[model samples]
Target chain A: MWGGGADMADPALRPIQRDWLSKTLAGLVLGAILALACSGLFARLNTAMPLGVRGQLAMWMVPPVWLGVLGGVYFFSSGVRAWLWLGAASAFVTGVFYLL
Target chain B: MRSEFVRIYKAVHTWTGIVAGMALFIAFYAGALTVFKEPLAAWASPPVAGRMVPLADTPKLIAGVLAADPATARDFTIHMGDAEHVPGRMGWQVRDTDADDHDESSVRHYVGTLDATGQARIEASHPSQLASFIDVLHRVVGLPVDSDPNRWVMGLVAALYALALISGVVVLLPSLVKDFFALRLGKNLKRMWLDAHNVVGIVSLPFHLVMALTAVVFAYHDGIYIVQDKFVHDGKWGTAFQRQQPAAAAPGRDPASMLPPLELIARAQAFAPGFEPTALQYQQVTGPRAVVRVWGKDAAAVSPRARGGFAALDPYTGKVINSDFLPGRQSTPNLFVSSFFALHMAAFGGTAVQWMYFLLGLAGAWLFYSGNLLWVESRRRKRPRDGGEVPAQRRDVRLMAAATVGVCLGCVCGISLTIVGAKWAYALVGDANAWLLPVYYTTFFGCIVWAFLQGAAKAAVHLLWLAVMAALAIPLTSGLAAVAPGLNMWVNTSLSSLGVDITACVGAAALGWMARATARRVRQGGADSVWSEGPQPCLQGGVPGVGVQAK
Candidate 1:
């Protein structure tokens, strides 16, 4: 009965889920970098954009990075693993930004 | 792990709900009333004489008032009371420097008419005491006579409510996806009650959440002292306020010099770009280093009350010294905090938002009522012992029934009486708001006590009927006094009063419906019958003094 239950079967698939989580995190990081670069280029092209509007656009950077953490958890094998990955990714990304 | 998470969340939800439920009930109820604060205020205040002062004349009128009462010029505030035609007026409050004591004793010093030469004449109208009373009720809940301890008690209750909501959401998570829209009716009383509670909770979850969180913030503003001390005062806990004091005050010491009000307004406009200056002040007026402060509205901001920018002008020269708009980066936290207020108060998107909040508020009220009902129903399955000696089950029944009828109907009675008190105060003393608010609240609390003494069924029926009558009398009283015709004329010309009358009519209808429903329930259930009378009680009688009986 325990073997037939969804709970027991879920752990067998954990390794595959871990791989998916790592892939998703990598994709999100790449996407964020590209988007930031594009926004910088767009701002250079459009000089008339108000300072407030530019600031608002810049604030959009925080939410996406936060969302990537959540996305990584959703694809992970377990909540603990998901949290670990999220913490690591967040630290690395935040550190990179701080260094820049 | 999942099960453990669920268990923790369930505990949180239950405790939070239990603690915060009563305060949330009061908050949501009074907040619903506060939606019409402006109209209610107008209804409380007497009609103003003369046409509304022209926009152009406002500055002149204000100037005249300041010149006449030179003492008031130090620190003063003006309110543009309502719009024209429907008793719209203007008033001001000036600090009474003449007082011997150092404590501020500002008086409601009115400036009525601006003469042909643009001079102000003193005018007096009663303050919207009823609306203000309702506002206090919405905020602190404990009126003056209720004892000061009630405020702290309510604050603690609010915090508990936040906890309950969090715990509730946690408990619901496991079953949420499967039974998101589940509402099984017909038999299985416990299941039915659970379904009802869940449905109400989930449907109005967003509103309830925002309201709970913001209410906690408001109730526990003192908690911010921790953050203020750490972040605001260079890591020093108690000295934050002292540090900010110098910056907040006037920079210069000029007592004799004053800036041209229009120039200050113009400078403020320059800072905000599109915003109109709503208020202006000259700080340290007579000194050589006087500064003019200009404050105004920014339509793009989340709330109309959100202070956009400040422009300080050198009073003697009319030169702009500081032009500062709230920086977009720094404004994010403020925007988030204010968005909570806007969401809770339905002040952001105007009428549509107000209606949405009203519906949500009603739903929240229903959620609490249903929750209590569920508790009663769950216990009702266990039958009380036969005969005169009160079984613990029976006592539980009586108390829950009393609370259900007393608190809910008592609120209705209180609000209705407050309206009546407003009218009566106006009729008898000409200034109704002052006395009407306290009278209505007294009547409301009396109803609660009255409900407790009587059986729940009887109390419910009586108060429901009383509410219907009171609500109906609102329009009738106005009509009989010929105020209705003038009110109708005003309603045709103004949306505010029309909305007020329509809301009153709707309230009358709702009370009438409640009366009928209570009467029907009384008829079906029979007089003196307790809610917990059947077989289901036996299945869940683990608690002492409660027992299940065979049919």
Candidate 2:
């Protein structure tokens, strides 16, 4: 997605040795899972609400949660850590979703 | 954030922006025009003959049309206004079954009206699709069709845009306080462009945030609903929105027995006093679960959708079935969600708010365009101290400039020419709807090719001039229509249509000014920059940031 690392030759880029490619891919994938899990948990908690209302709320929740993950995913120092932590968070959320 | 993190975020902001900026330019530019969708539709629609049917006669018109053609009973609308594009008191659309749900271009429009004798007359009107065509471009970032795949691509772009917004704020956090609203119109072109970009982005950060989040939901809401059905609603999502059915079976309801359109509006008005009814949409009127939604705007409240909020009422009893989506009448939770839609669609605070959104949208477009300009300007290599040669610019810089010039200006020219083509196509081919896409794509691709062939510097000026001409043609077409009626073209004197022409005139003046500035830059600006018309020379040593400054 970074498209050939066109600015790789720039001195400013040399210091950042993190795995951007894997981190971005992890953000895309795990962030979606985490978003879906959050939405599922939201729906379960609001099960008593009318489907018309709850469904809309759930659908709208996905973007922010997913984008939140994508935006903050870079805070991790490396792609491996990003994947591990996001993976753990997604698992926790999914477990909570099923438990409800 | 640490300095290292800021630097990393700066890179993130740059890459994400470069990837999504051009597409967002089309989205924001076209989106700005879409704020006046009704006006654009009115401007493009040829005037219909005869006066509109009276509001009192709309019930009769609906009964007559339904009796004549029962298929229309599935869904139809009775417009309450005298807008130029309203066609008549009653209008409905028959959409192609396979067309994307958001695709309005394939829909056939029909209007029912009472003739001189008070008999129902149904006319198939070919209302121009120019407004919706531009809307489709805005929705899917210049895609011709609003299909699922295209929307997913739009979803990707929206995600990238969200990332860019976040990273951009992070990158600016250090200098944000010091440079708030700073506009240094100085010789340091790169700093000037950066300041301008930062100011727009930061000031409109909330607006862009709403746009990005809402756009993501719009692009992927269908999938989200499917997921919601599986994990959230336990696969009952499809039936949840359905109205409750009675146990006793009965034949199809009679349209004539249903309440009049005026009664529905009255009921809606009673439910929410300030909610003005613009149209009465009768859905499944003949079916057991019949619903008549009185749709309109309430200037004081937020609407759930672009068509404004609606109060769903039972056609037989005139009882309000649902006010969940009604403006000024929604529950607090529902209203909270509705605010999102209202903010994104400019469905609140009336025309003043609409104008604000329009200007903000244009400024957003300029933000992205200036980002590209800053990109090219920052990468510029300067002339050597010896003054013997001009350093050759990187291939990426030249390519980015070309793409930026091609895509952004192409969209502007394409939309303008296509808008102007609506009347001409109607005059010549007798059907304007079919010519919209072809004319737009032809102009769009032609501009892109011109950019690549002429190079960014020369093509930017040329395309800007072309854009000026195309935008100017909008009002000229209307002017000619009024003066020379023999051309079979038309002009609408209504405020909405006239507003479109006036806006286009202003747009043309802006484009004209940019064209002049760009031409001067190409002719007399920096010799070592890609924007210059002068020849590039390969040199071993060149001093950076020591040459002529750009505007």
The numbered model that scores best in DockQ is 2
Once fitted onto the true fold, the runs of candidate 1 whose alpha carbons sit more than 4 angstroms away are A1-100, B1-16, B77-90, B94-109, B115-119, B123-125, B145-151, B226-232, B235-300, B304-330, B382-393, B483-493, B525-551
Worst 10 residues of 1 chain B by lDDT: B532-541
- TM-score attained by chain A of model 1: 0.42
lDDT of 1 by residue, B262-350 (tens): 65566556655655555555554544445565655444444523233345666567677654333221255345545655666665555
Q: Give the DockQ (C-alpha) for candidate 2.
A: 0.40
How many angstroms is residue B41 displaced in model 2 relative to the true structure, after the best TM-score fit?
Answer: 0.7
- RMSD per candidate (Å) reads 10.3, 5.8
Two-chain DockQ for each candidate model: 0.04, 0.40
| Per-prediction interface RMSD in Å | 11.6, 3.0
